[model samples]
Target: MTQKTENTQSGYWFSKIPSKNWSEKFFLYWSLVWITVFSLIVATEAYKVFYDVEFFILGLFVSLPCVVIPYFFPCAADKDKPLWDRYWVKANVWIALFGFVGNYFWTHYFFVLLGATYKFPVDFRLNEVPVFLYFVTHAYFISYHSATTPILRRYWTAFGGKKSTLKTIGSVVIVFAMAYFTAFMEAWTMEKVPYYSIQDRERMYTIGSAFYMIYFIISFPMYARIDETGPQKNEKWSLSRTAIDSLASAMIVFCLCDFWRLIIGSIINPTNSIPFLGTHGIKA
Candidate 1:
């Protein structure tokens, strides 16, 4: 078998020449369309928040794009291949499952422990998750694994000099920095939308961001190994393998987030909350 050479220019912004297959073209086009639509929703939310205006329909538009934007990036396994190709399909499935389950734990369960809860006025729920929020969560994972991580890795490898230790240290720093920014933006947006409320806003913002930082520390490195475009891409794809990897990633993130909850919950509100279990009572 001939050795596969990766495109040196491939990163967040560019991939190799896009597949000319009609199905692939259609998928890419619609992905861009949905991303634009979602951006509009985000923009509407921003306008309402900035102008201090209230609109009953605003919630409907707030989160749907977040789900679609992440899918816009091409999968590593088949960057220039048809959408129906086994690698593309399997990789997307892995990412979707990982995003959905991981987000559920962090958004629904973990946030409650930190004295925060999502307030979606539209009230669409699937098994107790807000439907729009589910999409938003999936989008977050897609964006990170597909786009952000690659870009960060490229730069870290470039700037960290020839030493492996420097590369390792730089990767960690980059991961933490990216995670912190993501968490900070999440906190800021929650505050802006008035979608979530916290008992101690200032402390939660700081601590919650750190909790996410730990999550990325584990996720970024793990993804680098399992990504379809990574070392395992040449291996035959299988449902069993995808399921196992996705479950493992979700479990790792869940445990890490909960571990932080345990440690932080004990210090912040041990009287009402159990360590590792999170805070008591649902927020109104």
Candidate 2:
């Protein structure tokens, strides 16, 4: 339980004792809306002003899991099981890492392709941090779906065997397209904001989007498996599965992604060259 303290004389907000389930309140519909929908809007708008086509492409791949994932995989928690178990926690962590770590590979390569001699002056090691951070920060999208996925288990359950497969495939396409559209919108945003500049970053964005689609198509089966397992309250290992809780878990994962980058950045890119997630994350 969390503990809270108060000074009778001088007023000061203090510690709060852990309510039986307060720590996990984040894994609900409210949390998902807060994190995912709004993020999509802001990211969409930001990309439009800041990076245009780059954002559109990024948005497309991101949409696949964001949509298909939550609809299919249901959570293991309910009124009977008040507190989040280990599996939920673990699931969240993994999805976040999956996106963050995965992107590192592409982002670094993009930098190499980018001539550091430009006005931006990218150092191979330093510039590459943004690529890694980009992936890590974006990983939260998957996490949000993970949490929300549980809520929609009943809906997907209605569709069985052939229908379910059809729905899943169709969904992948829809999300992929919607995400891409957003990417395009974001690309437009880049024209205005101009957060980044160079020659072929647009191409890099396209490549990244393609990678996301390929990865999502391949990963669908695994996500389906998670759906099959549904929510298992008794399962002690469950809460740790941060991959399970789409919303709250994703936000938590987002936090971890940054933490992971921070730890790595301390060693590799201390100059805050990571772009969106530099020394002053989401700031400069």
Candidate 3:
């Protein structure tokens, strides 16, 4: 088969070209739309055209494409399978589940570590935090993970050869660099949103990215493993397997974040509370 055909068949969602499956294609479009919308919103915010609540709501709306599309349109390879067995459905469910955990639980890490305050008020909330916050994180995560996949894939193809030591070293460097850059970009991009406030801008731009880096360090590689093909291909992931992987990654990050809190304490804010349940009651 041609290289192009091989890539298309690989079902690598990170590719610049569209995936062979409609479900992944739609998801790619969905991610691009939100990433663009987010950029536009950031631009508007820069011009004093603020719509913090509306923007978050839009994020929640756009995030549904991943979940909604898979129900009606399973990938071609998955047409004979059950709903949860479908590749797109499994991929979406995995990401949404991970994003949910991150927002519901890890949001507190931002509060305690970076002194992040969600100032925009909304009526619906789970534990004094906006309900849309959880879903909006889905959109953000889609973009972040999508950005990491292609770069890492390229690096792995080029440098991750038969040498296990080189592979390990290359993986470490690439993962750290990508994680740090993506974390800093998100923090910097949303820094001016008026609602998402951090105590120290300078610190957030610099050292704060390290704290956020923990999330992608765990997620980027793990998420890429979903529905693998080509040399990376093993067995396709079951929905159960997907959930287990995502949850395990989240748990690992949770432990790491708590470890950071315990050992280093808050980097941005010295007088922060580190509770097991996170900073929900800390009055963000």
Candidate 4:
């Protein structure tokens, strides 16, 4: 016969096991495995041969803030909140999906219709775009801007206290600067891996960088409004809500990009048109 005691060693073990929630457990295990694999790959020659240094630098720039800000000042949704309430996790999931989908369409336009090619390491094409490239360009970039914009806004408010014309102008300048730098880096990296047959590298750099600036223009203010954690604590968080918002944002960006292409084709040069097949008399 066994004594039924709530404080038994076996009972304690079972109790502790059940206390760990599935979402936390899943994320913990997944993070550990991902970090281990990523670290090992970076340690290998395969990484050196297959990965571009610029891509790595870009990833570092974006991912560091995403990790650090949350570490020190985590989203209110993450504190004693349910898994669905965790904005970061939800954002990542939604962005990754969007990235993959968006890349599938846009990449084909650039590569096939526009007759562009990629450099060696940066050329691991998947669904038209590079695999790891999606993480740098989409996942990390979106998350970084979404999380940082609010923090930057708060900091500016704290420093300036009351808003002024000068402060507002200064904030706009700062935001533009950040957007330009990000676009510049991406364009600079792409230039390093010259898209074959696409002469006029400077033109590519200028246009590509300018086009990417739209991402920040649309995302910064949108995130500032929708991605707040502190204000969202009182509201119920669910996967469906996150999904809807993310999808809406993705569609907005997509339409804007396509619209830009249409405008460019009509005004500038049809040869420079994006959204493949959007331009009349253009053959893919």
Candidate number of the best TM-score: 3
**Candidate 1 lDDT by residue in tens digits, 133-211:** 5555554554555545455556634542245776678777877888787777767656655556576777667876776
Best of the two (2, 3) by lDDT: 3
Q: What ranking of all candidate models by TM-score puts the best one first?
A: 3, 1, 4, 2
Q: lDDT tens string, model 3, 125-231?
A: 66556777777787777767766776676666554233478778888898999999989988887866777777888887888889999999999988877766434
Q: CA lDDT of 235 in candidate 1?
A: 44
Which pairs clash in the backbone of model 1?
A: 38-65, 262-276
List TM-score per model, in order: 0.67, 0.40, 0.82, 0.57
lDDT of 2 by residue, 1-284 (tens): 22211222222221111221221233343345535654675566644442434444454444334323433443333324433433333444445555554454433322332211112222223333433234323544444344334323323443432255676776666545644544444344444334355345455356433323433333332442332344552233344443443333334434543443444322223344243322232112
Name the candidate, 3 or 4, with the larger lDDT value: 3
Clash count of each predicted structure: 2, 65, 0, 0
CA lDDT of every candidate = 0.54, 0.38, 0.71, 0.50
Task: Choose 1 or 4, whichever is better by TM-score.
Answer: 1
lDDT of 3: 0.71
- Alpha-carbon error at 244 in model 3, in Å? 0.8
Measured by lDDT, the strongest candidate is: 3
**Any runs in candidate 1 off by more than 4 Å, and if so which?**
1-87, 156-163, 226-239, 266-280
Worst 10 residues of 3 by lDDT: 11-20
Local error of candidate 2 at residue 222 (angstroms): 3.9
Task: Rate residue 259 of model 4 by lDDT.
Answer: 72
